[model samples]
Target: MRRFYAILVAAGLVYMLFMFLGTIVPYGKADVADRVSAHFLAKDVNSISPTKWVEGDKQVPHSERVYGRKGFEDGSANVVTSIVVNYRSFDTLGEVTVLFASAVGVGLILGGTRRMKYGRKPNFILRVSTGILLPLIILFGIYIFVHGHLTPGGGFPGGTIIAAAVLLLYLSNEEFSLNMIVSKSLEGSMGSLYVIFGLIGLAAGGAFLFNFLPNGVVGSLFSAGVVPLVYMTIGLKVGSELSGVVAEIHEEREG
Candidate 1:
């Protein structure tokens, strides 16, 4: 009976949609006059035409302007990085704050008085392999964040990758533990560095996160003014925060 009612409701909605469209469109075969009327109704009834859509002469898009000027102005090969770190940096900071709050919330909720040792120790082979792989994974994460201004990936994904490497260690070694104090400290420090950079921009250039520094040669490692610096700070902050989140969950599970 419920399904029948739902079907009826869906059918009624479809019927209403078709009826509304029917009112806007002529019902039957049309003469030249009807065809003209229909054309005007569909094309001009909206009170604007393609020619009049914009207020001025067909303008070049802002993105196009950015692309042409990015080399000198932003010094980043990757356009997305320039936008995120230089154009919309405040939003990125807000995102970091939200992630930090979430991590803290998880810790408060899951942390308890008792110590936890849940998973059994893995074999020697697994342990040794993980130990070997861990450094490489961390290095890759660092590379990803460092080259964010020149490449496809950025701080957020690179940081998550680093956290995953840490998680792999936790899974392989039962005794492996994340020091909450150290992780939190690193997270806090990175966050502070990000803010300090913004403050420096404000003091030096009169705007928060202003590109006060020189934009080096495009495609160079040290280019992109504050973009790489901001991304690196974000990478450290995200990596530590996510690692702490996983640690909290692991502790709760083991306890």
Candidate 2:
């Protein structure tokens, strides 16, 4: 009965979504860009005083007027970053929830207390190579998430990269293990921090995950206000979650 109700609720939501979409007038190719997207590209969704968008105007292109525009409302240089982490950040939160759910499901199914194992013992070369490359990989992951607002990479990809480093360690050294205390602690804390930041936004600006912090000059490391901090928490959470998954899989494989 609960499953049936869930299906019913999901079906109703889909119907409502389609109905909402049907009501939206298609802003044609030549029409003044959708105000939401226009503002996103302009990096001024948080603008105290926003100018309304007009026809034949900015759509996807970053105008020189907005390029490196100081005192930006969003302060994120990457347009997609502005959209993903700034404009529709709630969607990004939903994405984090989805990944968390997957990790939980995997843990429930593959949970184990045994040691992680591989098919055969790796040689010294593999172990030494992993040792040499591990720091570099983790460093690159940090770079990716740290520069997320300025570049193409973000928390998800960056965290995955960090988890890849953990995977490398497991493959090269069968006895090597991640400290569960630290891993679980980091994962739980980071996830909680992500939501706490959202709650702070709610308290400060009447919106969850609001960019309440002041926008610094565009194209700078500290420019995107609370965005970089948010990404750092996400990267840590995702890294720990995925590392947990890798541990589970490896432990179950040879257990």
List the candidates' TM-scores in order. 0.70, 0.75
Best candidate according to TM-score: 2
Instruction: Give per-residue CA lDDT, model 2, range 49-111, as digits (tens).
Output: 345433355433234335434333447877677778877888998999999899989888887
Off by over 4 Å in 1: 1-73, 113-115, 123-125, 253-255
Worst 10 residues of 1 by lDDT: 39-48
At residue 43, give the lDDT of candidate 2. 50
How many residue pairs collide in each prediction?
0, 0
Put down candidate 1 lDDT per residue, 83-199, tens digits, no spaces.
Answer: 678777889989999999998899889865433665565778978899799999999999999999999889999999999998888888787788888999899989878877876
The alpha-carbon root-mean-square deviation between model 2 and the true structure, to one decimal in Å, is 8.0
At residue 60, candidate 2 shows an lDDT of 32
CA lDDT of each prediction against the hidden true structure: 0.75, 0.77
